[model samples]
Target: MRFVRLAADYPVTVFGLTFEKLLIIGVIAVFLLGPERLPHYAAMLGKFVRSVRDFANGAKDRMREEMGPEFDDVDWQKLDPRQYDPRRIIRDALSDADPFAEPATPVVARAAVNENSAYLQRKRKREALGAGDAAPFDSEAT
Candidate 1:
């Protein structure tokens, strides 16, 4: 008899491991590990698996404690690699370029002339000793 478990990311499967695949892996392991040493190695493997599960659970609990219920509400599927289809991306990108929309370069072009603009004349004179373009980003200002 085979037992099936529902996975949050993969439905109708248990971490993508099936009974037949596990059986084949077990057979190969028995051959490689040998019957005499199989039990000892299996015990160690079990311990490692338990530790890994415990660590993952502990991390998840800690994250939940810090992030609150919103942590679980995060859309995990959006981060999946399968969601990024290049063909779909290119199509969307092509469609997103509105034919009637103004060009994006105007802001950058305006910024280029801003150094000599009336409002910045005083600052420009002061900074004339060492004029350099400073790109400032404020994370907290957001």
Candidate 2:
């Protein structure tokens, strides 16, 4: 039952090798391959890993370019799993308010109407007075 539980819950790790085991294998490889040959092999391995990484990066860049505007417009930083969910936050805020409720009868427009009327009256009076009449006269009587 215990083994079954381990197999069911953690199937992958159950058969995985540890770091110590990998170290032992590397030591054995060095012995078999010899110290001098090991450096050359290690260099070749490093080059192989670098080439594979470069190829992968190039492919990714090419794919992104080919996808054109669709992929290009995506904001990778916003899409990151670690970022907060904006939709959920907005939904929670909206749910707290009753949408069907009539918005407090919009503040009576009487105040604005009065202000508008006063403005119009002043504008009309200024227009009727004409620009010359609106000008100030000097007491010196030039």
Candidate 3:
């Protein structure tokens, strides 16, 4: 089975909460708590946000400490999940080894020989068939 990515126009979400959904939640909270209690709850929310921020900063600091100078040398952008593309990744991996380049080692030479033979076999089969003929199909292989 294959996975499909969402369309570009799809709404951005954070933990399944979109901007509209967050606005709705805020409105509901204001109505439920009323003006008198809203300030108290808002203050608590602010404290919670501050604590979360502090916790994240602390974790980052701890990681920096553990990683030492290497932490600053890291290419953080390359590691971001937002830029991920399975097709691009697979293409890059496949292209990393230049197939046409001279194989310096015995193992790579053998691989190139095998690949060339496979290509030749496929080419011969195609040439054996007429232009109008469909390629041979193996039901058992499927």
Candidate 4:
């Protein structure tokens, strides 16, 4: 994954494509389409992407309607594609609120610290084994 700064404010992580991968794609496009046809191909690709985006927005709107008044105030446009999952959102919203909400005790805080330390140790071991190096594999690869 690669991080890109949007509007110099928000950092978005993109899952695919590297500089080398982009260079290879450009080279292949040049070879296959030639200079004269490249612009037309690019325009077509842009249009296709726009159409898909429109279709997706339309589908989401329909889903929002089907979901009803509980989600009436939710703004789909503000949703982050990376962090948003509709089912999870709905599940969380529908879950029962704490009837007896109380301040955390010292024991609870100690237990949380112990759990976090154990998690950090496991994460360090995984990193040492190079298990975190796996990149997302494209299913379209031949």
- List ranges where model 1 is wrong by over 4 Å: 1-25, 97-142
Each candidate structure's TM-score, on Cα atoms with residue i matched to residue i, is: 0.46, 0.36, 0.57, 0.37
Candidate 1: tens digits of C-alpha lDDT, residues 1-142: 2233334545344569876788888899899988899989999999999999999999999999999989989998677675565764675578868745654543433335656677797666567655475545689999
Stretches of model 3 off by over 4 angstroms after superposition: 1-12, 96-142
Query: Which scores higher on lDDT, 1 or 2?
Result: 1
Query: Which candidate number has the best lDDT?
Result: 3
Give the Å shift of residue 112 in candidate 1.
Answer: 46
The C-alpha local distance difference test score for the whole of candidate 3 amounts to 0.82
Of the candidates shown, which would achieve the greatest TM-score relative to the real structure? 3
* lDDT on C-alpha atoms for all candidate structures: 0.73, 0.70, 0.82, 0.69
The total of clashing pairs for model 4 equals 0
Per-residue CA lDDT of model 3 for 1-142, tens digit only, reads 3344545556878789999999999999999999999999999999999999999999999999999999999998778676678785676577767755654443433333564588789988999999899989999999
Query: Lowest summed-lDDT stretch of 10 residues in model 2?
Result: 1-10
Q: Candidate 4 on 1-142: residue-level lDDT in tens?
A: 2233344454433357666777788799889999899999989989999999999999978987898876777776567475555665675577675534542333533333564588788777676776557744678994
Residues forming the 10-long window of minimal summed lDDT in candidate 3: 103-112
